[model samples]
Target: MQHVPFPRSVRQKASLAFILVMLLAVGNVSIVQFLLREGDGVAATLNVAGKMRMLSQRMGLSALALHQYPGLPDLAPDQLPTLFDEAHDALRLGGRAFGLDIPAVPKALSPQLLDVRQAWMRQQLAVDALARAPAGDRVAVEALLRANTDLLARTETMMDSLVVQAREVQRRALYGAYALFALDLLLLGLVGWVVSRRILQPVQALARQCRALAVGDYAARSDLPPGDELGELGRALNDSAGRIERLLRDIEQEHAALADAQSMFNGLSDNTVAGIYMVDESLRFIHVNTRMADMLGYPQAVLADGFPLHQVFTGADYETVQAQAMERLSGRATRTRYECVARRGDGEPIELEIFGSLMSLHGRPALIGIMFDITERKRAEASARRAALVYAHTSEGMVVTDADGVIQDVNPAFTAVTGYSADDVVGQTMNVLSSGRHDEDFYRVMWARLQDTGRWSGDIHNRRKSGEEYVERLSINTSYNADGSVNCRIGLFSDVTEKRRREASIWHQAHHDHLTQLPNRQMFEENLRLSIEQARLGGTSFAVIFLDLDLFKDVNDTLGHEAGDQLLRLVGRRLTECVRSSDLVARLGGDEFTLLVRDIEDPDDIFPVADKILDSLSQPFALGQQTVQISASMGAAFHPRDGGSDSELLRAADLAMYAAKEQGRNHFRVYAAEMRESVQVRQGEFARGPDPASAPAQSG
Candidate 1:
């Protein structure tokens, strides 16, 4: 038979079509979601810009009121400046602040926003100058008035330009979305066409051929060209029909041979391997060949003429044998083959395969049978069935390879685990399953150990037919021949990928924070200890910075715990970004985070990192529908200067952090001896009693 190469299997083609349709559908969904998010951000930014226009004029009016009514605290206009600054930041830098959710300004509107910023700065200076001047200073009032006008004009221009740019972006995004939708539709139609032509048509053709074969059309052949699994099924159907036709023809030839056997056996019965016997209608032995006579445990003369068949053939299958003999003599069947137990001359029961045919002797219908003792063959067959059952049903994957590591056979479990059928890996080297994670030396050592001990058991990394690497616990044993030469290698393995993944996940959860996925207090302390040891040995130093987010509790109280958690995660990311890759940042829980800067050559080197952390945290964090601005009160403790051990360094860092909070929030302090003394003095003061005049003010 000629081999016809298929472009792809039916399953692969169908899967490809399904995957293409799914990708298009997902792509459209993703594009829509992305555009909607961007649109939300843009709309929010425009709204904030519109509010800035109003805010510029409102601030000017409030300033004028404050100048006119300095005695009324309600008309102080202090909040106006703060509100104006918040709006300006929201419009220029963009985030959710004061409920004005937005993204940063677009690049096209950056110049306009810079002009507005400059104008706002001049107005801020005038406001400050007016506040410092005497209440009746007309020059101060006039300067403030001029700055407000310029600021208002610039805000309007920036807002107008932003609206134009936002419209253009929205229009382009809409066109792009429309084009993507159209392309998705076209691909879906193409997929449908492929399904019809490549899958449905071949399947229908195969179905028709199957129907023809079912109606006794043994000559039918499915003329499907090989391209997929459907084509392979068609070919298999054709082959089955041909096999049935051949079997029928073989039966006819067997019948012809049976007819000739009746006369041919008379001359050759004594020389044949199997015992031959003739029986009359009365079921008595009419003639027995020499082999048959020996099988009956009698001389040829005693077994001949009137010997009862039951004497040597007495077993549970006697009735079945009698019925089959009758069927043969009645011409119901030209030949009958059956297996039954028969007693040998030694009184031992043995399984026999008997072929019986109808024959004529002295014009009377008789039965002639050729019998063979199949006792050993039956035992071998039963053993083979048991072995095959174990091979097919066992859960562990089993592979048999030649001494040279060429794969010869694989059990069903092997295919289930490795995604490779026996036909796929047979005749291939075991290296086909190599994951390449192990170097050549690894395999060389494995083989060396196996050669020395004739067995190797360990975990091995291998790849599946799908190109996914997995680990398996494998045990391989060498099978040897009688001469002690290696015959084959048998390997049993079970997939351990999931087990390994679960172990890894557990370890990660133990050492990392669940909310931020950052190193937790435990891991951070371990690293700190390690850093201290390394620094002490090398005569180098490292610094530990402890930070507490200011107003973090206020955020939680105002925005809910979920928002607080989001803020913490964002802060973790920003903190990570602030430090070098060699530096370690960890959350010490709640609002506390710690950083370890390694190989600090100077204590002053820690100040820059402290500043960066403060600055990064000062940026606004967008949490769901709200945005929050927060800062960190940080403290730094050097290795030797802040005491040597982990506990000492941590205590120093804690004292300095408290000092930063006492000095005022949103500040950092390096660990100093005076900080501890100050803390102890404050503790003593707290123990005595609260003194309103001298007590340090606390900020949250």
Candidate 2:
């Protein structure tokens, strides 16, 4: 019988246990039966052989007994009942052995067992024959014994064959049992395979979940029917996968948010008002934002892919900016500002102001530049500067100030006129220059006038830091606020301190001949007015004296007007010395001169000065080489006594001088209004002839 390997659980438990019990029962029963059969058969066979041998020996002894006890004759020779009994018993044992061998022996050895049975029978027959024969038949008994021996040999061979056959049969039966065991094991495996289906079902489901996860099927799950640990594990897998799906979704959402933020930052960088650009270590433009692109009239989308920035900036300028940015990065400088011209897309040039700084992007050195158009602002500033320069070089002093009378600005002309540098006066109150020549009340009046009329003009004296004073022709105006408030005051002025001095100089040149450099008659009369002011103020009386150089025109007709003029200068100097420093001297015309004496109170007080002037002219004049003589006729004017004005005084004095000339030459005369009856008028104006003193000189 084949053995089936037992399954550890389920149906195999009871059935295999039962089968094991049954098989063990059967094996024990069969083993006991076989043991008993084999041992009894072997013992019965040995008993049979022993019984046959004993039967033969007994027959021999009986025969020998018959031979030795022939006289007794009680033992039957052919049919001894007792001997048959022993023989029968021996045959019964042999038959029992045959019966045992029939059950225990193999079929292949049945003949050999049958032969042993037949040989035992033949030996029994032989022994019976020997017992029936007479005692003389000893030869027959010997033959029978000999035949039994041969039969025994044949029986031993049969027993040996049966033993070998039985052992061979036992081996075959053992092999059969093992074969049946293999078949039982094969059947159990088939049943086990069917049993494993329930288990493999869950495993297959787990495999599907794993496959789904591998293929990114986050929704896919084992979904195994719930029962045991496998099912719970499947559910856990589904939960884990769900969590992974959520994580993936979260990751995706974060990625999108990051992308959106990056886009926003990019937009701001591109669209900022300030141009932005980045340059790499090679000094090539690495990135350019929209504003930077727009600065050069380029679209960002088209130009963000960098070009060499040096194409726009000369290499020298680029390097300079690079160096400066590097310096700033190294903390070498505070701040640097640069401006340059940049070309547009159309090749037109415009001014740009650039500020560059050092920074790193993506872990590499880069220059960040901010630039803008400064063209208009730069041009306007340049124009304002030119106007300022023009104002600085102007010929007249100018002060520009706000409405508070504070100096906001000044020019070089102001510095020259005021003898102050711009630094000394800027921002100071305009009152810093007030000369105090004008009263505070006057300034109040001026301010009131300006506020009322929006402007005021006057001659004001202002002082300098050096303590020098100057007169300014000042015109000040108030600049108004939009709301009509006074916002600023502007004052412009010219220094006129030298005005009176220049006037006196021109007056001297106009009345006198250029050659003699002395006051002429016109000025002599004008001096009479001043002399009267002196006489009235100082309680002094002064005379107007007129003299003509004698014979002065004759030399001019002979030599030239130049030589005559020279002689006139000589005469003018001689007359000039004859007068006191407080007196006035002038050349009336070509040969005439006038004098006004100051501080003469009495009428006799004038003649001495007149006589001395005449005496000085009587001297000879040395004209280079020729000596010439000249004489003088003098006229005098007295304030209040001669005439009320300079004209009246000159007229009275000239008539008196002509009278003196009529008396004698080289003399002086005192003016008297009573003698004026001899004067004549023509063209309705006084035709006053030569001086009265000179008329007498002409008479002489």
Model 1 TM-score (2 dp): 0.38
User: For residue 202, what is the lDDT in candidate 1?
Assistant: 79
Per-residue alpha-carbon lDDT of candidate 1 for residues 1-700, written as tens digits (9 for 90 to 100): 1385323887788778888888998898988888888788777877877777676777767677777778755443567667767877776677675586878787777788888879978988887788788888999999999999998889888877877877876997899888997998799888988788778887788888788888888887878777667787888888899999899889978998887786586665865467888888888887788877766567777777778778777756788788888888888886989998887668878788988888888898998888886889999999999999999999999999998889999999999999999999999998989999999988898899878998999989999999999999999999999999999999999999999899889988998999998898889889998998898799999988888888887888788888888888899999999998999999877788888999889778888888888888998999988889988888889988888988888888877888898888789999899886788432331022336874422211
Candidate that scores best on lDDT = 1
TM-score of each: 0.38, 0.34
Residue-level lDDT tens digits of model 2 in 1-700: 1385434333444465556556655765676576566655655545544554455455545655655466655343544434434433443333433233323334464565556556656666665676677877867677677767766676567556645655655666576567556755765565455446445667788998889899999988876666556777888999999999999999999999999988965875767577777767676677777778877887766555667666676656667766776676565763567887777887877788888766777887667767878888898999989988878777778887776678987878888888888898888977888898889899899878976898989888889779998787888888898999877777777888898458757876777767777776566666777777867787767777766555655666666666776787788788778778878787755566677777776889777777787787888878888887868776676877877777677677777776666667787777776657754321211224445553322110
lDDT of each: 0.83, 0.69
